[model samples]
Target: MPLNCGIVGLPNVGKSTIFNALTSAKAQAANYPFCTIDPNTGIVTVPDERLSKISALIVPKSLVPTTMEFIDIAGLVEGASKGEGLGNQFLGHIRATDAICHVVRCFDDPEVVHVAGAINPLHDIDIINTELLLADLETVEKRSQRVEKLARNTQDAKIKTEASAVAKLKATLEAGKPARAADLTDDERTASRELFLITAKPQLYVANVDEAGLANGNAYTEAVEKRAAEENSQVVRICGALEAEIAQLDPPERTEFLESVGLHEPGLDRLIHSAYRLLDLITYFTAGVQEVRAWTIRRGTKAPGAAGVIHSDFERGFIKADCYACEDLFKYGSEQAVKEKGLLRSEGKDYTVKDGDILFFKFNV
Candidate 1:
């Protein structure tokens, strides 16, 4: 996985608008479909409510949220597989992403043109998914041809394994199933994982709705829900225009705005947190008066690998770590109290980190 998601949808589906709101950077948003010719990449901070609480308790020089990468891909169109309307170029960008956030335009706007000439969520999804299937089919078929030669040769074990994996993947793709749907042995999966095929990653549909849709997600959301149920995918309904406005407000005003809208938090926060969990990412904190920062790591990250994210030296000379869960601090009110309560623990390199752990690393260098 690339540790990032790519935003994709048909032209004028508010992909760029959402991307700009995510990064708070201008990425050339225009009214027309395919206005964004090139992909715009952004690093967005993953918002955590716990970070604010932690900051309140232990004041730091700065509070930095863990970040994730988002790429705004050019809009994909029907007949894209046949190279219609810059489809081929756009598809290649999506293939490089770890996950896909398909932004379906569920809002009705006479001023903004719909690329498909109507506002049909299922039809739009099919157009994009069909193109992806076609692209993956091309890949599987091409790779299968070369692997067929090696599958018959008994001399090379590596080649034989690869050939088998490719054959399985080819069959899965031919059945209109994604590469991720293919069943492979542990070694085969490990070998094939590096291919970074687009269809192999999970997907979530983002219903870009209007104001009325945001409040209760009108008929458009219902359509998306039905489609998601069929595909076993999830839907996140948000108003892109509203989120963009919220992103511009100051902290205090932002909160006020959310309350006014009867929302507890910005929809972007929910979307980001959902993406974090979808990617199986967790945060562990390193806190001190000097700096208290959140670091992102895979869910099962062991001590050394988590430390390595800070610096190579931390892993290279790792001795042990002094750790206590943040929940312990919240309960005990202070580190000294945590120690007095016997909640603090000294862990060795083998310790697998738990979410909300506050760690202080010890090293030789």
Candidate 2:
């Protein structure tokens, strides 16, 4: 899974700050507009307690956790669709991501100037979303122009199907709705995927609050939450400054700091986990004496597809998979115990991999 989420919003809304905290990559989070001109991408390990538990059980020499990528894209302005403030470059970066994390400023700090001159989350969200919608509209229109001509002149079934999909997408984008909202069949969706519309990607709204507003959100966050509900999206509230400071501490000190703050975990962990789920991804494990490793796969991936995440040879020579739920391990206390209790399963290619599954792949290779 090379899939990644793009952190995007108007300038000075803590997109880079959150990104820097998320990856601890030092992406130059300044209090100025367009500070991040180039997209900064970082690989982040997904926090999973099961990985540690599996390591404890197997006593592996190495514990490898699954990872996901995050891209910090430059902020978008009001006229982004018309190339305002390097908008074209920024939009291109967003188009390449699998999902979106729109960071909305919910705290009013006079020192950190708001790009729109006020902390209005709903307005800010509309600005970025409108730009994305406009960009998608343009893409659909351009693609429709070429495809429509071919579909009318030639009776090719493939060309006609593509033209129909393009028309549906154009109508949806023109109405200020995302292409994802359009009623398209499976074949039409397959055809429309080639368009690569930014608005078609799943999105999560990130409400960046001050420390005081982290536990109970402010008015701005409430507004963001309301809008997200209307759009059937999720919102994750985080204190950007606090998380940035937390990112600088050692592991032990970090735990102490969080405990002192009356918190169990840093808010960045929740944000990372939310972004991972936004991609509709799930994790499965391979535990052994050599290593206890977590692997990422899409939600409905079959046994062979899950094995392919390890190596192509595993998929090619796949025989079957010996699998058991991690919860079964927790119950039985050992693999032998799990097998004795008849909790282990031997699944073939048709078996869909479940999250937290402990798998021993059987492959000739």
Candidate 3:
């Protein structure tokens, strides 16, 4: 399954501008609202400095980086749950994503119109979140009604479990809390996934600030950070207009620009890393003389399941994995040195993968 984050926000909040910067794609960005009706998706590489370090040390002939997807969905409006302004289509696109990247307008530019008629980050957040909450509320209500009836009639444990999950979801949504904040068991969570609740997905906020707001956050960004902290989520501040300009530069020019700007890397890099973490993703590496590649896996994924990402046959004939931490290689300067130091180990199927692991899978098939 492709792990994707849907970019959502009110109109003219720089969602498309950020998307275009992240992917270097020509997604239409206009001063007006709803310029993007259909979602524009781009495959974005998950930047990890470790990947390059590994390639440099191993001196591979080819290096491949793992990637994720980003979808720029249509702008949302108030009463979106009630089918206002392409609401149904927008909600569908969001439901299809694995996570959400909410873009909040933190910059005040009188030229670009704000859909909510002013520059209030908190209000913008509320409008978008309220619509998603309302949509999820409807989904849970409908599911609860059906599942409750079926649970009363049938003796199936699965039906009973789903009914219980639906009840929890209904109560949470009615209380104005997101479905994700609802207390659900493992089985309940699995059951809830079938409903594709918009509020249930992991979310982070992107504060679209201007050039002045980049160095020290403006009041709008401070408000956003406070809200994100309350929800235990993170906020990444980016200057969308500036990032777009940086994206257009060549590699050498880009590096120079970043240095001159007193930044280690582009803001989009932080955004991508935050999104990857929000989705609970980790990267492992496979190194050889011919190629060094990075593979993405969910956090706490076991050896066999991770092997399956490479090929189905690998998992079917799974034996063990030769795993070593990439950090150990950085410390020791060679894989053979890692083995001598006993950092490398033969991991079994029960072994869980860790971030920055360099793995060599061994299977019969």
Q: RMSD to native for every prediction?
A: 1.8, 1.1, 1.0
Candidate 3 residue pairs that clash = none
Report the poorest 10 consecutive residues by lDDT, candidate 3. Answer: 138-147
Against the true structure, candidate 2 reaches a TM-score of 0.98
The Cα error of candidate 1 at residue 187, in Å, is 2.0
Which candidate tops TM-score?
3
Q: How far is candidate 1 from the true structure (C-alpha RMSD, Å)?
A: 1.8
lDDT of candidate 2 over 1-365, digit per residue (tens): 56799999999999999999999998988888988999999999999998998787779989899999999999899999999999999999999999999999999888999888888888899999999999999998999899999998998988899999999989988888888888898889898898899999999999999988988898888888999999899999999999999999999999999999888899988988898899999999999899999999999999999999999999999999999999889877899999999999999999999999999989996
Q: For model 3, how does the per-residue alpha-carbon lDDT over 274-293 read when each residue is reduced to its tens digit?
A: 99999999999999999999
Index of the highest-lDDT prediction: 3
lDDT of 3 at 122: 94
Candidate 3, overall lDDT?
0.94
Model 2 lowest lDDT segment of ten: 53-62
Off by more than 4 A, model 3: none
TM-scores for all candidates?
Answer: 0.95, 0.98, 0.98
